[model samples]
Target: MAVSLDMLSLLPDPLLIIIISLLPFKEAIRTSVFSKSWCNNKLFKLTTNIEFNELFFVKSYQPSIKHLQRKAFLDFITFWIDNNKESIIEKFSLKLSMPNNVSELTEKCIAFATHKGGVKHLELDFSDPKWVEYNNVAPYHKFHEPMFALPKHVYDELKGIQILKLYSCRFVEKDLLNFHALKEVSFGWMEVSIFLINSLISNCKMLESLSLKRCWNFSEFYLRDRNQKLKKLVVDNCSFQYELFRVVAPNLKFFKYSGMMSYFDIKGCPQVEVADLDFSTEFGFGGKGYRLYNFMEDFYSLKVLTVCSYFLQVIPHGSDMLRMERNFNIRHLTIKTQLNKSDYRGIVFMLRSCPMLQCLTIQLGCARIWPNYAQPFASAPKNFWTENVRIYECLKSSLEVLEVKGFQGFDKSEIRMLAYFIQSGKVLKKMTINMEKDIILSCNRNLDLNPRKFAEFLLKVPRASTDLEITIC
Candidate 1:
């Protein structure tokens, strides 16, 4: 033990600091008691990255003493900051539930983090886990706890931050400032208005990615910047105040949205290659299928597209507007659905639309059923795939790779769907099927069903491509 301690003390100061930085903040501080050299050397004080998570300090089995815990946490942070005052912090992340009166401490910490223009990545998550659990359905703005309002003066010092993420925090439009060096920004569970969003985009000229999740208080979102450097945009479960959402970022490459259906008039985004749309709708709200069609048609340069079961359920069937001659440039298409009767027409429509599709992935599973959605899991018709099914254009030409996930042998609809693909895919080269054992047992109620036998049965099906290969797992 003496020799080990001597060797540890012999390690270079920079190497010791690097080792200490890998540990949690609390554990790193505890190294002071390991030896006299650790205390005198102050390796923990030299760490460039400081992260404090309340869960690390408060054990799950401990009695809840909110006031005492808060004080201890804050005091520990103050002590660390005092010791590391001269150190250049590259990243500062604090995840804790803040009381309404703790704004001063929060501001102080923010000031220290940006004191010398050193921090490049910063995250401040003040959301209380208990609040999220109790009011899971309500928006963050409706929570009883007051959100931490960002101090206006802090914005002036954030010019050096390249990545910023804030959760359950408040931001005033007037407090917005130019983050010239910022490359990515994420805001969740807050109320962001159109003015605030527009101002952020205009100010952060170097911004490349922006994400907003579970945010409310503004409806009309219009982003129209031609020279923008944005490449990825994600809008998840945000409540829009209007029916129309427009975007015109010419350099965007990836876009993802999950919310209720609306008229998305995305223009000038010729560089978008990947898009994921997860739209939810109730029974009475299923009439806006044309809007989805029109929205999908706008992605002229889309190379990959992903959609949920609800997206298929809402697409209009046999409508003249839906039949308007349009084709997509998508080369890869992924559909997540439960393979129900109502999804048949939509699946066919999507296959027909993607004429250049080279790869198709069908995820056979049930998604989260939103509220007021009636009969979202109804079984497919007995002869749905067999009746009047014609080989689509892509199935005969461009489609070469097919992948099916969550496959169960007993489901007749799933079997027929695979059979249809095997017979129609002229150029198909590789087919992969991932079996779900739990689902198979639950649906069949018999343990004797062998998945290998099912794979063998599929091998007997007629194939249009003589070079096709099949693998099941």
Candidate 2:
């Protein structure tokens, strides 16, 4: 009695499918070749991720593949399905980079997905203009919506696809008319209407995670309809007013945004416990107009907060940022510096306010702004980075494990700050720097000291209070 493929697939799941993809095909399908019931039907159960990327290379472009030929790329997908029941396919991704055949390929893909069952996750990306359309500029407004034809019954037909990710693809208002089952959606392009996006989300009963990046066309998009099922959302580099997120996701757990849209009204997301914010504005941050005190009200359950910002140009002085007077209740906080000078004080204030903050990552840098025209320069450059060391020194009280990056060897201000950390960083558990040993000892210099004395000086610190680790990188 020959044990058949059905026996091999008797205990099959996502893990088994992944294991099968890794094995040599001949050996992988040996169970199928053994017997009949173990035959074609059950062999494919241990399978997932059918990628048709092989059908799209530049050197030998398959002309008939896009023409819907009997043996086209989708045909291969159909053959794979016909040979076995692909009930295990969780993610069906297609990234074709051929020239001017995206529409044809797109049509076949949608047809295969609609006709074939079990495709719950789909990532359809035609980011390159050459593959999508033969023009110099892609018709960004039309790709995604057209990928899957406007069906008469989208809710009924697409009841399976849970996660939909489209990059450089178009999403029309009518597309969302049927995407009620969609749980997570991430999309990017030059222009996407917020009104259209809102209409889509309004109808998305099960939609959860929404990430929009670099979409400058329409500025104001609001997720204020607090009754929806959206749990996590991230908006990046879009110029919308701060009033959008005022309602807060009562059930939301993780909320993050990176860009100049600083007017965030957090009163709404009362339930959001974790937030990652990067308000490193290129134009400037702070001014008498900025309402930074709005943050003082309450974030009762906020356990983790990450703040990334650029040089503060308009930070409200004497406010929470510089004064450390505000009250915050987070348990773990990380401040990654995307700012130069102006943004530094605000960050210092944020860390100080978080009396309960346990973990922190203070990085350095600024946000880049893309302008419609060339910028005009008139004023002399201000030295903002000169205060970076001082800011680090300010953080010595709470920071237990300090990791510094982008360090230059032997700068006086930097050394002074390090010296302060060596002595005043009493709470520090470990110090990690990207400089060599010579650089570390430069902090405590003796006029006639050798390397041995320098090493000795470091050995007598407060019971290994300063555990120094140096690396070239």
Candidate 3:
């Protein structure tokens, strides 16, 4: 029952189309007039949600779609609300690109959804830049304000929204408290101002989950209150001021992040269950001050941990890896890095740290480079870790399920690393050598290490009782 110009030509007559589209139960009456053979209530009912995806494009000569005139936009919106006044929309969405300056059309859509109380899920996608480029949308100024940057009276009409998602749309402090029942909020690639941050804390009282990904400018966030019923919080890939992990959510069940020079200062929430902290360490950060050590204090109840492997050359200055001995309650640990250099501190950290550490999947690299000052790792001072990584022979004590992705040759460093795992992980169940094809081709073409020989050397490593699995891709 799509309303289209061709719909009239497809049917027998104009009067039939008018009866089919404009009247009450118009479809039923139209089908009755169409010899009764055209009756299909199930199809029409099912198609009710099938919004006409009326996509029109002008390729050769881009049609300057007459700018959505203010009057027409308002009238069309008013008509929709007037018609569906009794119907409560479950999912309300609008993707019309109103001329950049005239945000009134956009405002009307928001106002309509606001007055309509049944909107449970709402999505307002600002059109993609390329689409605008193709369409020749003139005077297209970027949106750097909240989706509904209207006056208070405008927002007064909006209420009862649950899940609100805004992508690439700026949000101001005032936009925070607009939705009283807002549960889940997602802001992608948008700037979050300090004022807006505080507003969210005070306003979004029932907010259960919040994710700010790639949205930048504000860094080092401090929650206004620690106990805001929020269960999950995720902040990833954003460039913000370096702040220690300072979130006080006693009810927070999950906190995940992927960033630089960061640390977590959890408020001891027993509810936090899983943390995907791909946090960088000193080694991961080219031997900087401390690789987000302040974060070691988090995860009192963390059950899952995924750590990025340190770059193999940068040596940590202090007792870098030792401090991590007791912090993690990880039952599953995935370490991503290689023994590109004789990074003993890193080796020991991955091999030994997790006392309760069970499932271990090591995405290691074969490219090895030892520090010029590096003698046997143990020769370094007690404060100087990587002193003797042979101690990794200790990992065999409890580690099981070892998956080494990006495996290359059995270089001396890798042999040493592998030997440690074979000896230490006595309880080891399965050891896998996941090698990439590029590694073999690179060795053959660049490093000149015979792939077959290197692989054979790795296979011969002594694993007392552990079953080994080698997979090359």
Candidate 4:
């Protein structure tokens, strides 16, 4: 049987280029051998995006041949760029290792992408590929500094770029200038000074989203721009030199922070609609709980709130609960926590604070507990859900949906918590219990009970909402 080789030839050049672009870099280049029309300059010159990854070339090779592979990779990219010099690339991504002498090559690549191609999205990841093989715990600090430093003149060419992501590359802060077309920027595993960060934010007037992850060398981060156009900001696992962190973006909408708890002074961001707080450290200080409580008051306009188990455990309870005078405008609240004795007071505090909450989601067994000061998982009292808890306004009126994710069938505390919500949530419309498959396997091995029967038993529980529907999956 003869197959039709002319089928690909019937498609338009733009469509063929797109189809080839979706393939792996090696496979994309290999398509040129199929026909002369699909050669290097003919079809690929119209391609708007290109990604060159060094790991892709060296993944199957031994460590000794990696240098030769790197050379070949460089030559191939150089040849490709020589052929497609006139093409306007929309996105250019290069992930490779940078030794001491590779700055010139890096600069040339950046120049090709920015000055020649007018690339809008550029990502240059110079992080060591071995970092991945070592479970992302490679000793990056042992290298003392980032191997590659972005040249000062490169900032001028980056003005047209809309999205830029740099990993393990140093920046010359003094050379930074206005990026008029830049909208989103991300920095990972790099040393960012406070002045440099502030300067970037000030200069990138059109920047809408900013993310910093595992960044070091900056202590006091202050985003005090009143007319800032930033809409979303994320700071994840960044090591700070000091404890002070503040933000004053007036037009900011979404803010997510995940790291050690610090002295946070988030204010002036009245337009914030969503906030995620995931602290890895345990609350050990005297007034940290009070500080967190006061910190939450700054996000008055927040509609969606996500908190971790540590956040719940740190909330001040007992007499301190009386100090919570502000009711959050959060319509949806997601708690990524395990149902344990330590979380009871914090859960109650959150429920009381969000009176207008319309949706409540409890994600179980996903909380990151600090290794040094992990809290014990003790069972709650028998009357804990009934007599100990007060009827919150959200459950009585505003709350309509309840979702329990990562549900482990054997936890009595979790079972009681679900029952409490079913019986108290008067306006509730739906309750979804998403079970963990591993939990089901364990239950089948240890107990004689069927999961369906257990689900049916839960359905038989007395519910306050007459129109409520329960779904178990």
> Runs in model 1 with CA error above 4 Å?
1-87, 98-112, 130-146, 151-153, 281-283, 318-324, 367-380, 408-410, 435-449, 466-473
User: Top model by TM-score, which number?
Assistant: 4
lDDT of 1 by residue, 1-473 (tens): 44444667778888888888777667787888876778887777777778877766655544567556766888987887776678777888888775356777777787777788778888888877665422223322343333787767668766678998888877655555567777888888777776777777788788889898777767687876644788999988777778678888889999998776767888778789999987643333345656766776678789999988777766543243233257888899999887876676677778877888999999876534444434323444787677777888898889999999877655677788889889889999999998776755554443344777787888999999998999888
Q: Cα miss at 321, model 4 (Å)?
A: 1.9
The per-residue C-alpha lDDT of model 3 at residue 79 equals 62
How close to the true structure is residue 361 of candidate 4, measured as C-alpha lDDT? 93
Model 1 is weakest, by summed lDDT over 10 consecutive residues, at 132-141
Superior candidate under TM-score, 2 versus 4? 4
Please give the clash total of every predicted structure, in order. Answer: 1, 25, 14, 0
For each candidate, what is the lDDT?
Answer: 0.75, 0.52, 0.53, 0.75
TM-score of each: 0.75, 0.64, 0.60, 0.78
Cα lDDT, model 4, residue 63: 60
**Per-residue alpha-carbon lDDT of candidate 3 for residues 1-473, written as tens digits (9 for 90 to 100):** 97435343355543453444333333333355344323432222211111111122212233444233434544555565555544434555554433245476566556555564556666565534333221111212233433333335434544676777665554444655778787887775457764575567568787888887656666576654444688888876555576554677778887787665445567555568777754342223334324444344445466666655432223233346443535467677765665443455554554455567677776654333422334224433222322333444335455666776666654555555665666556677677766665755654634435767766876777765545454433
TM-score of predicted structure 3: 0.60
Please identify model 4 stretches exceeding 4 Å from their true place.
1-47, 52-87, 97-112, 128-144, 151-153, 282-287, 317-319, 366-383, 386-389, 436-450
Please tell me which model should have the higher TM-score, number 2 or number 3. 2
The candidate, 2 or 3, that scores higher on lDDT is 3
Clash list (residue pairs), candidate 4: none
Q: Model 3, residue 423: displacement in angstroms?
A: 5.1
Q: After superposition, how far is residue 470 of candidate 4 from its true place, in Å?
A: 3.1
